[model samples]
Target: MTDDAPRNSGTELQTDWFDTIRINTPAVERRAASLPSRRSLKKEWQAAWLLNAVRCMDLTTLSGDDTEDRVARLCAKARQPIAPDLLDAMGVSGLTTGAVCVYPTMVAAAKRALRGTDIPVASVATGFPAGLMPLNLRLAEIEYARDQGADEIDIVITRAHVLQADWPALYDELRAMRQACGPARMKAILATGDLKSLENVARASHVAMQAGADWIKTSTGKEGVNATLTVSLVMCRAIRDHHDRTGIAVGFKPAGGLKTAKDAIAWQVLMREELGRDWLRPARFRIGASSLLGDLERQISHHVTGRYAAAHRLTMA
Candidate 1:
C-alpha cells in the first residue's frame, strides 16, 4: 500500500500564505515539563504502549562506520524487533518497526535484507544533516537513493533558507526533491533544533507540507540538540493545522535523542493528545532512534518476567 505517498502532489506553493501560528514559549515549556508526571502507565498497559512504540519506530543506523553487514543485521532486527518468545508471550503478533532508516548507500543492503517484509527502507538523502551542497547534487542524491530501492526519502532542508526567511527558496528546493523521489515518500527534516525558534519550527513545517512532504521530521539526529517535546508539540500543532486546512494527513517523525520506554510513551502521549488517537499509528507517527529498540526490549522483558534485564542482554543490532 502507498499510504505514505506524498499527500499534497500538484498543490501549488503558497509562500506568503500560512496561518498565524504564534507560540508562547513559557506555556509550551511548562506543558512539556508537566508531561512526565501527568501521564504514566504500568505493567500490561506500559508493555502495550512500548509495543506500539516499537511498531511505530523508524529503526535507524546512520553512522559513518555503517557497513552492508551492519545494515543486514539492522534489517534482520527490523524483521523481528523483539524476541519471538517474548512477542508471543506478550500476545503481540506480526510486530515490526515502521521502517528501517539508513544512509543512501545502504538502501540496497537494507532492501535486500528486508525482502518479503512490509517494512520500508528509508534513506536519508539530499545532503543530509548539513544540506549545504548544491541543489543539483542534493536532488541527484534523492534520485540515486530511489533508484537503489529506498521506499522513503528523508531529505534535510536548507537551514539557511529558514535562517534567512527565504520561504520561496525552501519551497522550490523541497518541491524539486519531491519530484525526484517519484513514488517514494519524502520526509522534510526541519532540523527543529537548528531552526532556533518555535515560530521558525511552525513556519518550516508549513512550508515543507506546502512543498509536498509526506512527513515533516524534527531532526537529522546529528544536531547537538535533537528532538524535544517542545519542538515536537510545535511541529505537530503545525501538522494539525495543515491537516485541518488540506484534509491531508502528513506523518510526523521525532528523530534523535529519543531513548528508553518512558521516552517512547511520552512521545506516544504527545501524539495521542495533540493529534488524536489516529496519529498514534505507524502511518501517522514515527520515532527515529538506533538504541531505542534495545531499551524498549529491556523494558518489555521486565514487564513479562517481572525482573529487569541488564541492558547487555538486549541486542540492538
Candidate 2:
C-alpha cells in the first residue's frame, strides 16, 4: 500500500472491544504449529512465494555500530536484492526489497542512498528496544526522524501500560505519537515479549490500532523473545477484529529472530491463511530482519541452479 491510502482514523477508547477476550494458549499453539505442516510449496511455486517474501521484507540494519557506509551498502542491496542472473533465471525483473530500515541518525544517509527509488526509509524511534523514556522525548524523537526524511517511523510503546492494563494511557500515548508522525506513517511496536500474555497482546493490538497506528509490529528484536508464530497469531486476530469493527485495514509486521528461508515462508503462510492475500504485500506485511536475506538468497539459488550456493557467494544484507 502507498502512503496515499486512507489511514486508520482510529475510534474512541472502547474498553468493551477487548475487555473480556481470553486466549486459549493450547489451541493457539496447536494452530500455529499446524500451519507449516499443512501448507507445502515446491519448485516454481516455492520460488514465487520466496520472491514475494523478498518484496515484503523490511531489509534492516540497526546495530550500535551502524554507519553511513553500512546504510549505503544496505540501500544498494535493497535496490537490487537478488542477483540479476538469479532474477533473470526466474523470469523476474525490477525486484527489490520492501524497504530499508535504519536507526534515526542513519535516515538521512539511507534517504540519500535510495534517492531515486520508491523504497521507503524506516527509522526506529521512541526509545527503541525499550520505550522507557519520557513521553515528550519519545514524541520529539518521532518528529526528529520525520524531519530527517524517514518515510515511516517505527515507535516503541510503553509496556507498562499494557502490563498494568492501562488501556487509556496506552491509547493516549499512541495517539500523540501518531500525531507526531505527521506524514510519516507510524508503526506501533508492541514488543509482545514484554507484554507477558496472549490476552495482553490482543488488547494492546486493539488499542494501538484504535490509536491510529498504520501497522502493529511484533517486537524490537532486542527482547528475550521477539516475533513468534503464537504471538503473531494473536496480533493478526486483533488486526482482523479491528478491521471487522472499523472497516479499516491495519498492517502487521513480524520482526526479530526470523533468520531462515523457512521462517520467511512460514510467516507468509500465516498471513495468507489468516488475513488473505491483501496482507501479503509490503504495504501491509513486513518481515524485519538483518540476516534473513542471506538464507533467502541461498534457497532461491538452490531452486534456480539445483545446488545451494555457499553463504559467501550471496551478497550480505
Candidate 3:
C-alpha cells in the first residue's frame, strides 16, 4: 500500500536533458523479440505471477458508452478483483488492482463507488488519446479532474512537439500539466505508437520525468499500435537511466493490446529485468487493461480446480 515515488516538483525547464540520448533500434527489437521465450511459468508459479500482475493492473473502462452503472460495477470488480472463493482457496487476501482508470467525467462516479477503500480512481485527461487541445484547456482539464476527486490524472503529450524536436515546448507543457494536477499524481502518456522512432520515445520519456511526471505511460490505447515490447524496452530503459542520474523513481504503465496472462507476465518480466523488483509493485508498475483480468481469473481457476473453466463461468470484468 506504500509507495517509494516522491512528489515531482515542476521545476524550471531543463535544457540539454536529451543531449546524450541514443536508441539502437535493432538491439531493442532483438531483446523484445526474444522476450516471450525468456520467461515462462506454469501451474502454481504461473498462478502466483498472475496474481502479482492483477495487483499491479489498472482495471480500466474507457469506452464512449461508459455509464455510471458500468462505472459502479467496474469499481465493485476493482474492490474484489477476483472471486472470493478463488482467493480464499489460493490463501490470499486484500488483493486488488492498482486502481480504476476512467474518463474525466466518470471520476466522481468511480470515486463514489470506490469510497472507503485505498483503491484510487485515475482519470484520463488533457485531450486523451490525442493531446491536440489548446494548452490552456489541457491544463484546465487536469484541475477539473482533480476537483472531481481523481487521485491520478493520465495526460497525453502532444506528439507534434516530439516530432519537431521541440523539447522546450514539451517540457513547459508537461511541467504546467504536472502543476495543474496539484495533489493528484500525474502520468504522462508518450503515445509512443505515434512518436515514430525509439529515439523519440527515449527523449519524450526524459522530458516527461524532468517535467515532474510521477509515471511515464506508453499509450492511450487509441493508437494504431499500443504498448509494444520494443517500445517498452526503450521507455523502461529511459526510466532506469533517469533514476540513475536524478535518484528519482518513475512508474511505468503499458496500456492497450495487453490481453493474455502471458502478455501480463511479459510486461512483468520487462519491468523486473529492466527496472528491478522494486518496479514490479503496483506503485511503480501497472498493466492498464480490462479484459486482461478475465484471462488472469480464468487461468487462476484452472490452477485451483485442475480444469479450465469456460469464459462465461467468470463474471465480466
Candidate 4:
C-alpha cells in the first residue's frame, strides 16, 4: 500500500490481461511456514479436488436493485437435489454442494429455504464491495449477517488504503472485520483489480492472512477487472508463504469473471498444483461466481447427453 504516490499516476488502475485461453498465475513466493507435511497435504488435496461452488452475495444491487427474480431462480435451483442428477449426468461422483450465497439482508431467507440441505447461507458483510464505510456500521452489518444465519461473511478491504502502501491499514481493517464476524467464517476480498500490481496483491494477501482471514478473495465482481490467474497466483504465493512461517493453513477464492466450467476447472487445477495437496480442501479453496452454476449445469447435461443443454438461467456468455 502507498500513501506517497503522486495523484493520478494510473497507479489506481490496472492494465492489460491474457487474451489467450491458457492459464497463467503471477510469480509468487512459495513455502507457507504454517502449511503441513507431504502426507497431510495429500489428504487435504484429495479431499478438495473438483469441489466447485458459487458465491452470490449482492445479486441484488446496492442502489436498490432488487434480486427477487435472481433469488427465486437460485432458490428453485437449490430446492432440487443436485448430486444424483449431476452425478449421473456428468459421469462424476457428484457435484459440489453449491451454496446459495447472499447478502446480509437475504441471509434469513436463504437459510430458511436451504435448511436441512447441503447448501449453506453466505453473506457479504462489513461494508462489502467498497469497504469505505464506517467501522461500527461495518461491524453491525457483520452481526446482522450472523444473526440472520449466514455461515460465511465475505468482506472487502479498503482499496484506497491498500493502494497507499498502508499495510497496517489493510491488516487492521481485516482484523476488525474478522473479529466482528464472530463464529461465522470470514473471507477477506482483496479486490485485486483495484490493487493494480502483483506486488500489491502479494502484500495485501500476506497482510490479510497475517491478520487471520480464513480466505483471501480476488475481486468483488462489481469491478471492470475481475479475478485473473495472475492475481490468484499472487495470493496463492501469499498463502503459501504465510503457511510456511505460521503453520496455519488459509484459503483462496478467485471470484468475479469466472463463468465457464473450463474456467472453474482450470483455476482448480492451478490451485492444486501451486499449493500442492493441502490447499485444495474447501478449507483452502473456492470459486466465487454467480453464473458458474448454470454453465456447470449445461456442461454436465452435455456430458450426459452428448449434446449441450438447450438453455439454463445463466448459460456461457
Q: Which candidate is the best by TM-score?
A: 2
Better of 1 and 4 by lDDT: 1
Per-model TM values vs. the true structure = 0.96, 0.98, 0.97, 0.76
Q: Write the per-residue lDDT of candidate 2 for residues 66-140, one digit (tens) a residue.
A: 999999999999999999999999999989998989999999999999998899999999988798999999999
Identify the runs in model 1 with alpha carbons over 4 angstroms from their true place. Answer: 1-6, 15-19
Query: Which stretches in model 4 have alpha-carbon errors above 4 Å?
Result: 1-64, 67-72, 79-86, 89-96, 312-317
Task: List the candidate 3 regions with Cα displacement exceeding 4 Å.
Answer: 1-4, 10-12
Model 2 spans with C-alpha error above 4 angstroms: 1-4
RMSD of each candidate relative to the true structure: 1.6, 0.9, 1.3, 10.4
The better candidate by TM-score, 3 or 4, is 3
Can you give the lDDT of residue 240 in candidate 3? 89
lDDT of 1 by residue, 239-285 (tens): 89888888889989999989877899999889888899988888888
lDDT by residue for model 3 (1-317), tens: 44845765644556566667777789889999888778768778888889999999999999999999999999999999888999999899999889999999999999999999999899999988798899999989999999999999999999999999999999989988988998899899999999998889999998899999999999999999999999999999988888887888899999999999989999988887899999989888888999999999988988899998898889878
Error of 4 at 293 (Å): 1.9
Error of 1 at 188 (Å): 0.5
